[model samples]
Target: MNNYLIKTENISKRYPIRKQNARPDTLVGTVIDFLYKPVRNLKELRNLSSAQNSDYELESYIWALNKINLKIKNNEKIGIIGKNGSGKSTLLKILSRITKPTNGTAIIKGRVASLIEVGTGFHQELSGRENVYLNGSILGMSKSEIDQKYDEIIAFSGVAKFIDTPIKRYSSGMRVRLAFSVAAHLEPEILIIDEVLAVGDASFQKKCLGKMDDVAKSGRTVLFVSHNLESIISLCDRVIWIDDGEIKGDGNPLQIVNQYLETINNISESQIDLTSINRDTNSSFQFSKLIMMNQNNIKSSSFNVGDDLIIKLKYSLKDQNLLKSNLQVKISIHNSTQTEVLNLNNEVSGYIHKLINKEGHVVCKIPHIPLGEGIYSINIEAIINSGAADVINNVGSFEIIPGDYFGTGVPNNTKANFYCISEWE
Candidate 1:
């Protein structure tokens, strides 16, 4: 059975710049209205404006959505992605009836339960329990319906202890989790979520995304918008690229993500000139750029299991005491959870303070980076005179990659995130 739960035609919804004005009409005014109304031509008065009523008037008034056309079948998962201010939230809002489109109509074919914004329509004065029932009814759930799912919502939200407390006192993450639980348990045929996943910390975000996976599997259409490319690729089957109120591309998740990345990286590398990285005239101490030495190792998008890597820092000192500076660099590597795996520093061995040679350009090398294959960033600082003055931190971003030294099948569903050449069993 082919079912199209949502579809849109060449649907157009237009509005004028000025609303039509009406005035009090007496019998005498009515007599004048009949005579002057013909001469006035009220239709002409409502013809948008001189330059504002073009077929594409989006230039003047913000066209939240323009000529959007797509047919989504039941249970389809559509992921929306774009840069900030690219109409992603606007599209979701239009579909949710939060706001009407300025120029195009969207035809939705199922009941929608949305968590576009946290604490939407939640009463600040109401307790958590009252708000749950209030929000549930707002989502079309009857009182009995809300009672049936109350326990599950509280459990999934991890707010059973606070379920009776006033939500006005809940933390940001707690509020988000509760709101999401209410929306998820409503069991509407269509679910739309925005970047709420980016609200909480890594672990809570993971739990929310996992819950969304189950919600989608229960035969509900999902339209999710997120900036996390990793999450988007992992969760979405098809991706839509919306830019400047138009659909740029729609295709497989990975391809769309790769295209978006290439576009962003190219712009970052091109438009943001890396040269002239810094300028500080006080005491003559400054660093310009920090980047990976062998970028080709990373550019190919593949890494071997045990490849040596180095992070290079390029800076120039106008004038300084090279020996008195006593340079030091601190580097920390973190996992996906932002948990520190290693905090390698040259302070203990005094290697960092040792690199104060004229300060034109310097490279800090992690002799043998003891970590698995994954994305990592550095926190760099330069301290002078026994941690007295001169400090620069996270100057630039770099990564330590795990090389596929062992020719094994692609790693999946395994905790084998690390690849080290150590003697074992």
Candidate 2:
């Protein structure tokens, strides 16, 4: 047996395509006029051996993992982090033997168990009780082995009350609890988990991480893939970051991941010009421009919560008695994966009663800012006050990155998005 628990050398997985021309606009022959001129970002594709019709220059093969090389040792707990389509899941699948490599070799040295999707490989048709035995057998456990661990699994899953129920009837969270408990209790030599805790509640997630830690400390190897950087830093000794089908960075979980994050932040900051923000798509009530104003009504984008936020809106009202309008501003603070951490919706004004023909500034003085340090996205909408009625100023999205607040832990979730600055008894 190899001393390293898992090894992969230049491993690549590719999907073969027969070929079809695809673009953003028009049918195969839409008979549309060329003057319409749809806007699109061009994609550069190149070199696929079996691709027919050199007519549309072949693009690069969409290989998910390009020449990945890694060696995992026994009892090592590793985390994988990256953006969407970063091949984090693909790498796990290859190691789980669920998918085969197209270009290189991946070798595993021990009995392996993988939890990718909660309830994956589970038979919906089977009763929860029957599925338990089935999963154990698939894991190469004998009946006696499963029986010995059955109670523990049942207790951990907290589904013992409904053990006889059909698994299909279980809620998404329940399925996750049951599936995680079964896999965790089974005692596999190598545990490959990919964002499984995301389905469970927060407490369950902490518990599951504790379980994984126990397993790793007891000499079982673990490979984890998650978007939660905190978990990656706390639970993993190292990290492997995949990006655009290649290893962008691989090393200490914190340092390398921080570098990747700075790159992401910089890329996002480049797109915040907001110059054409108020342009109308269909030309209803035109929003000329809006600016975040201060206590003195000075326009600005950056501000501390509780500090005055002025909204100077230059708009042309197209209709009269546009009465009962709501000028609502929504702020959503999200993580890199787009999971909403904290959301604040301030209904700054209602019942615009009448429209002043000319443009004017709508002042929104925030008496208390309930947020810590983080980045947030703001959306401004002028609603006609009914369920899904005509939207006036539909312009949404302006960045509201939080400044450092002394003595507060950095806010990064929906709860941490803002702080109340309170004392807990």
Measured on C-alpha atoms, candidate 2 has an lDDT of 0.63
Per-residue accuracy of model 1 over 253-283 as CA lDDT, tens digit each: 9898777655443211111123354312133
- In candidate 1, the residue pairs with backbone N, CA or C atoms under 3 Å apart (3 or more residues apart, or in different chains) clash, namely 303-403, 304-403, 304-404, 305-403, 305-404, 305-405, 373-402
Worst 10 residues of 2 by lDDT: 387-396
Judge candidate 1 against the unseen true structure and give its global Cα lDDT, from 0 to 1: 0.62
lDDT (10s digit) by residue, model 2, range 1-425: 55898889998765432222211233522334233324211221223333222233333335667789999888788988876656788889899888777678988888988887666568988888898888767765789988999999899999898899999999878888888887888678888888877778988888988988888888888899988788888888888888766888888988978987765543132113333543222233445555555566555555664455454445554543332234343434444443555444455334242334534334344544555444433434443333221122212222444543334556434435555656679
Q: Candidate 1: where are CA atoms >4 Å away?
A: 10-59, 267-425
Against the true structure, what is each candidate's TM-score? Answer: 0.54, 0.61
Q: So what's the TM-score on candidate 1?
A: 0.54
* Candidate number achieving the greatest lDDT relative to the actual structure: 2
Candidate 2 residue runs with Cα over 4 Å from true position = 15-60, 267-334, 337-373, 376-399, 402-425
* Total backbone clashes of candidate 1, pairs 3 or more residues apart or in separate chains: 7
